[model samples]
Target: MILTTKSQFQSLIFTGTNGEYIAHYSHWSLRSVFQPIFGHNNILVGLEALVRIEDVHGESIRPDLFFSSTDISIKDKVNIDKLSRVIHIRNFAISEYKNLKLFLNILPSVSEYFALSDINTCLLSNRLKELQIDRSQIVMEIVELNANNEYLFVEAIKRLSQAGYCIAIDDFGACASTIERVKSIQPDIIKLDRGLLLEHFSGESNRLLEGIKMARALGAQIIVEGIETKEHLQAMETLDLDMFQGFYLATPQPILSCISNAV
Candidate 1:
């Protein structure tokens, strides 16, 4: 069943036959900040919801460290992912930029938890419908930490795609997966890893251009992440990237209206 209460922030507590699952927003000191994704002419096309956590003293907790420090069980990770989505949808529902697409990150392995009879899947689907968030507008960015289970990942992508959510391969170039993996999944979008732009590889520009072309030819859009300077932006201009996201364009913020000022 679905139950929620407001402490310091709204806490969504979902219980299934399995046991109690708590999305403790206040308990975890969790918040979601959105980074705007821009297309041609500096037009805002989407926003990626990034989770931020703070300590008791209101000190910021790095997301990576937060996850690493907590329980890494698949169930716990899935619960946190669900909580993030709920908050993002709730925030986006109240925002003026409802038309813009919302990109939500998901662990590639988390998909394995979403069986056909999964209660969490049902809850998530119901929540999305309740919020009136179109599935087409929500891009599920699959973060590839391990690529050994190609079959599992492919199956998960299929399920998500069939449910009408656009799939994206996040941190594409830096992932363990190869172009063969990209061809196998054929996601709706592929985000170039920030490392590719930060550390110059031999013929990095040419390599990126080729990569962009390859993704486009496969019917996927290319988004270059971490474009933090004019040089970065200028360097990508020649590649005809479908979208760009980085601190140079706009830092992740709590409000969508603030994005206009930043951009």
Candidate 2:
């Protein structure tokens, strides 16, 4: 999916429903985004969120670029109510289907800026109450917790968990940062990198498998990313992955619209 831009860096715009605009990428709309997953009962389920953007063909855009950017201006443009938008989306998703858990990501560093104030301390908690969704149903995917700020990262993890959100360490086995992240945050879920999944059963595969086991032993769920082919899906089966995501199962789709009928 392509980004729509008013600024030269159109990528930085995040348009929410009701014409709410935020210059920051954090909490970008996902009303057009869908999370395809095998439900607890092993059935294919889709948990849709608000704030998703559509591409030229009306397909949902992948959010990786939006969330993981290094540009400081992009980060600053995000609203302090970013987490509140997430909580609102989670509630909306649950209203449609009670079976699937709501998967949402958090910029731990960004969230700390808004959540630390005494007045807005219960922002997330109040949203949870209004949504009537269980904290266990919320999976907060955390990205980019590397060696530089171990103390702050740890504090972020502790705070989120204390606020009752399940944590998942995303992009594991993709970077050199894996083991250190595990030692520091101890996430409740470990999302295997798609690159390692491509190296299935090769020398790298063994290392990935070991990492998965370690996370599992720590009471973390294992999710394999980037399953695009039958072979990839089969390889994931061998690992008994707790969850799956990739082009094969279902690519990201616009939340308010249906999956593309082009195929």
Candidate 3:
């Protein structure tokens, strides 16, 4: 097994997949891939953890569909979400990119799990300590939350931040992830959604630019995602954006291979 933690192995959260650690949930196999985030002048600043899923027969599964499907129970979602973060942190802790921030996504629907469990959150903190990784190098990015789960989401984010991890509000301006979320969560970073970027290119007013201004005023660093073209990046350069991510720069790749190359 790639995992060294005795408790991790005992819980069966991970198993070796061709020398790389991967999570298993229900009938699907889960793996971690990292997409690099760049700053001005294409400087690599951070990496985002994205989950890749495969069915038992080895067919590729779209992660977005898997995550958004209502068929999966909330309990299962919570387990998979926790497993994803664990695997990403494990892979990152042993890699050359350990110096860069690792952005891990949190599903809002499962926010109650974190909101209610100090023991579980403490285990995560302990894992970081065992790996000799700095808490500040981790960024917990929470996705959009609906009204019903908003309070718990805030509590979860606060718990993580209080434990020394940086907080980020993911997919701002999409779904329910609105400006109100930014105010309530008060995240360290605000990730502008790609949809807003596309809207900008269509001459649909600079709402994305306005968002950057608002986030900056709130003392939050801005990361413009979906810079799919030179023009898109150019638009961001005109603003005071802090980081960028999209296909134009690089695509997500298996964490094992990425860290190997970096080594």
Candidate 4:
């Protein structure tokens, strides 16, 4: 294992096959945020990006401490850069395992996606081809959607779909246009938000169920997020969700290690 024991929590930077860096931190005291989900039977699966901080005594820090910040610009830039690098890394890892799919988190603003000109695309595509990764398995998870520009979002989604890239509406059930955008864009994947699962009372269950059914009918797959327990997993099963992600499974780890272990 390339992991090192240092402070209470140790952070290791994993270099992607594409030369990007992903910093992974884990603490031995608890379930660190850097866990990767396994499909069916521990066959290395998707990873959830998470953060863990340590104190002087090496105890793992609480999640709230890290997320309570109010800096908008810093948050946005970090998200944009992180997603781009992760995708490049995944592209490199896929050379060895052609069946693996890469799920990348995307910001809502289309402008946030790094603009790829013809030249950029050519270079990147060449790199991916060398790694044996097809454009189809790369799924981009758009973090949020609203009713503001249903038509425009749908158009953007269609263009991406036409290019063989899969479109996923992340945090689906948290916004007003959940139904409208799903109907319009027809995303390949619809990810349920943790808020919906946490805040829903008796009255909201039926509506959530309807949303999932509507998405499925429109030819989109359903993936529930924020699952933290067996109860959440069982509830998702009751709802007939196709896939799920959250603490119940595993958190995101360095892509390099996940790839190495898969072999």
Q: Cα-based RMSD of the predictions, in order?
A: 6.0, 7.0, 3.5, 8.6
Best-matching candidate per lDDT: 3
User: What is the TM-score ranking, best to worst?
Assistant: 3, 1, 2, 4
lDDT tens digits, residue span 1-263, model 2: 11212232344435556333333434243343555666333466434233453444556544555444475343332442253355335434434454556666555555454334432244555556666767777777766543334566577666777767777877787653477777777788887888777676465678677877888789888887787887878877877778787778776654334443311
Q: Candidate 1: lDDT over CA atoms?
A: 0.72
Better-scoring candidate (lDDT), 1 or 3: 3
Q: Candidate 4's residue-wise lDDT over 1-263, tens digit each?
A: 21112331113445535453434433212221233444444355554434344444777655333323354344433433343434444433634433666665544444223332231354334545666667676676666634224455556567667777777887887654377767767789887778767754334676567768788788888777787888877777766667777766764544444535532
Q: Please write out the lDDT profile of model 3 over residues 47-141, one tens digit for every residue.
A: 89988888899998786677777897666666677778888888787667888899998887666556777833466778888998888998888
Residue-wise lDDT of candidate 1 within 1-263, one digit each (tens)? 22222332243534323231223443455566789999999999999988876666878877656554445454555556667776777777777777889998876656654433443356666677877878899898877566336686777778778888898988877655457668877899999888777654345565566667789799899899989999889888777788999999999987544766786
Query: Between the candidate structures 2 and 4, which one is better when assessed by lDDT?
Result: 2
Which segments of model 4 are wrong by more than 4 Å? 1-79, 86-98, 111-124, 145-153, 199-203, 257-263
Winning candidate number (TM-score):
3
Ranked candidates (lDDT, high to low): 3, 1, 2, 4
So what's the TM-score on candidate 3? 0.90
Residue pairs with backbone atoms closer than 3 Å in model 3 (clashes): none
Query: In candidate 1, how many Å is residue 85 off?
Result: 1.1
